[model samples]
Target: MKLESHQFIRYFEPEQAAQISQIAIIKKFNPREIIFEEGDDSDSLFLVLEGEVEVSKRSGEGNNYVVITSVKSNGYLGELGIIDRKPRSARVVTSQQTVLAKIYYESITEILANTKGDIVLQILSFLSQRLRTVTTDYVNQLAYKEKMTLIGEMVNTIIHDFRSPFTGIQLSSSMLKELYPDQESQEWCDLISMQVQRMLNMAEEVLAFSQGDTTLYCQLIDIAKLLQNFAKLNQVYIDFASVELIVSVEEGLIINADENKINRALQNLLSNAVEALDQSEGKIEIRARRKDQLVEITFSDNGPGIPQEIQDKLFEAFVSYGKQGGIGLGTAIVKTIIDAHDGKIFFESSPSTGTTFYLHFPIAKID
Candidate 1:
């Protein structure tokens, strides 16, 4: 049968339409035949003249069918290659005896050039509709993934925060049991109370984290003093890794910022640096200075650097290096805090020299 009047006029002008019809040839395939395979470099559009085809991919033990859009007498397929210049994403197989009008890219382009006015508008409109549909689908997928990630983070924070209170409860309950010798009932009651308090603390932390109330108030923070405090606090981790924490900052270097957030960011960097050292003797240099009204802080560690492939996405949520038991949210949280403060954070690293995280905060301008 001839190309439908509406389909022909929709894609090309009368003259070009006739030319395309003359040049196009109908190709037939048997059942289970390969019409096109994923990654094939064939930029051709196929208008089904008869039968059906299935687009799918092989996964695990079975074939996963993604799209089963039919291509009946006047329907089409293979337009993705023409638009994106990419290979097919799935294999198109002849589910049954199939016939299609194969129009190569050259012919399509020739027809498009010759076509004018509403004919061009129609073709473009069709392409635009298809593009919008695909874009919407992709955005929805990303949104779904983001929702799942947030849920996972909430669960993890609950578990992490619970550990502290749980440990405290365990210790307290054990002490109570030792004090109440032969009073088994009282000891069990103490244990239950401790466990309940532990759960309450865990619930509170989860609620706070989920509510996004982790950021504290802004104040004038002394960078040098903060580093000293952090060093003392994390001395155990530093010593366990045989790492030396060296701090260098201009005396009296004060910045107007959220002290808690900055401290958290610094802590994250230090933690990452220590982990990167892999329990080896390493040197971590924390330096801060005021450069042109910007407070620049640098965390440099002498350990194995990040790989090139993962560097670009280092600050993205849930992206972890080779460290076991590492939650990749630290850098992501640091970036989030910096961005909220209108500051910037970047890093540079190499295999032998290790990595350095550079954070810059604009000094509060005074009248």
Candidate 2:
């Protein structure tokens, strides 16, 4: 049923309703016709009178438009852009042959000048609601960006810590096999050596969380303390996920860095690792040390390794590895934070072999 201006007065005041009836033009749009594209400067408000309209935005690749929502008969659209004088953020198109009441910006102004105080209040109230919706959407986007940035930083730190131990374990294991010729006890020694090497590899994976070649701030930092505090804060998630976490870092190691951001970055990486494991029994290892002018950290997990195809772009925002319901923002956050701290990250992985990240930060000058 088509709603008359008087019947739809709930959306506008009596005086405003009268003004709309006088100036609003009823226009018919063909099916699949575009009402306006994003950034179009048609400052007009539209009220759907018949059929439906869809609002959508062009996806990142521009090949598709992700529909935000739809408007049915008696529903209104476009007031926000018209009132605020901003470009339309999304396109609106007719889903069928649609009839709409179009009120141009000039008509709205004239109506407001002639309208009663109560009618003006009603219009203002509707605009306020639209503003709130836009503000909430903006806040969500900002938060997602911040989270991705933090994840990136953590990956960088993990790589740095893993490099030294990985190098040592690789070199030491080879030497140990050469020096100890007894095959009987060699198997057990090899087991211990293998575990150590795995630890080193995990560190490298964590470090790889940073996307590319970037400068990092070196610093002396107490790695053990950092892990302990992080574990305490995230204990609920750890317990809920049935994940085991291990930490190893000397107390006196002072690493040069923006330690606070590093902590946040690591938190994001670890949280994602735990989530990736789902309901399975997951284990995470964190190790760090200060060597020469560098501070290194590694974060490794015993869950499924990243898929080969996605592993290459895992650090890019919204690049998920076929994980159901995954938004793919965690590793991106890890990269941004690390970049801000002037650090580097690297990753290593194989299916079922698990994944590890290495992070490196430069140490503060001893002098």
Candidate 3:
């Protein structure tokens, strides 16, 4: 884009615009290049001629920068430097190959000295608009932080309240196992105890996630065994739902992961599948295999697929479709757990067919 065609340049008379254009120095930058750093001596006003730039401010943590906004073609950056000689308050980086017209502080002052138009007011108006936008963003961020803090506190309180009952259940299940030494009875008692432990873990998981942490207690686990145990744990629900769950897991596949969290993630998928089936006769299939150096697992169900409107944001918090009384944190929690394990998750769905969620994890190194 030409400097003459710029809207900012049009704010001045033709003669003044020509004078400003004479002083403007065009510069080009490659993608991912830093144009300026926070705290650098502010000198020039950058008018974007091509591509885009990212504006970011140093985070409170001081180790990283949080992106505040993006300036695309025809937009302008560093307008504040034209008004004052203060240091740059934010960092600017090229989002892609970019071209910018740089007008130095001195050049702007010289142009203002010769200008007859209301150029000073035009610059001030730009600064005022930007300040308003930034202020609104800052306020919204504070409100979000406060809201999340309240949720964290509530989750911690609920977890504490549930701990005692979970303990009682665990003790009862242990006593049952001791009293009934028969294989079948002992199996039921063991399932009960395992379930009590899972409930406690689930409560803690919610608390930890609300506090923005997903601490993994990683261990080498047999993939086949994990899938088998998961199927067993949910056998009652599966039977009740009248769903045929087929598990096709390859043996000798191991992964380094948090067993409880992985189980919770799988349980969430199974729960959603059963709900999709609406207690009707349907099929749920889980398959696992070694794909290169990673273990690929798929959970699929032949129910009405995810709603088309929400497919793009399925993993985002508070996104739900065709569910009653769902707060929509299940898939969000699942993504967080998988990310903590350095794994990947994606899915395919069709209204005519069903939904299939794929999870991939690196194989655990055995020495």
User: Could you tell me every candidate's TM-score relative to the true structure?
Assistant: 0.53, 0.40, 0.72
Error of 3 at 172 (Å): 1.5
Off by over 4 Å in 2: 1-221
RMSD of each: 16.5, 18.3, 5.8
Lowest lDDT sum, 10 consecutive residues, model 1, at: 202-211
Candidate 1 lDDT tens digits, 1-367: 4654436434665677778777777788898798888778768988777788775544336543344233455556677776776877667887788888888888787777766777777776786776566556556545645664575577777767776877777777677777777777674756466445535543443344334445557887778898787676667667877888998888767777876667667777887888778565789999989988898999998888988999999987667885788757678777877876879999999988899899998876544
Local accuracy of candidate 3 as per-residue lDDT tens digits, 1-367: 9999887788788998998899899989999899999999889889999999998888677657666778888888887777778999889999889999999998887877777656767766867887788767666655545666676798788878888987888898888888889999999988988888887787778767766787888999999999999999899988988999999999899999999999989988888888888566699999999999999999998889999889999997667765788867789889999989989999999977798999999999999
Which has the greatest TM-score? Answer: 3
Identify the superior model by lDDT, candidate 2 or candidate 3. Answer: 3
C-alpha-based local distance difference test score of model 1:
0.72
- Local lDDT at 279 for model 2: 60
lDDT of each: 0.72, 0.71, 0.86
Span of 10 residues, lowest total lDDT, candidate 3: 139-148
TM-score of 3: 0.72
Clash count, one per candidate: 0, 56, 0
Q: Model 2: what TM-score?
A: 0.40
- lDDT, candidate 3, residue 344? 96
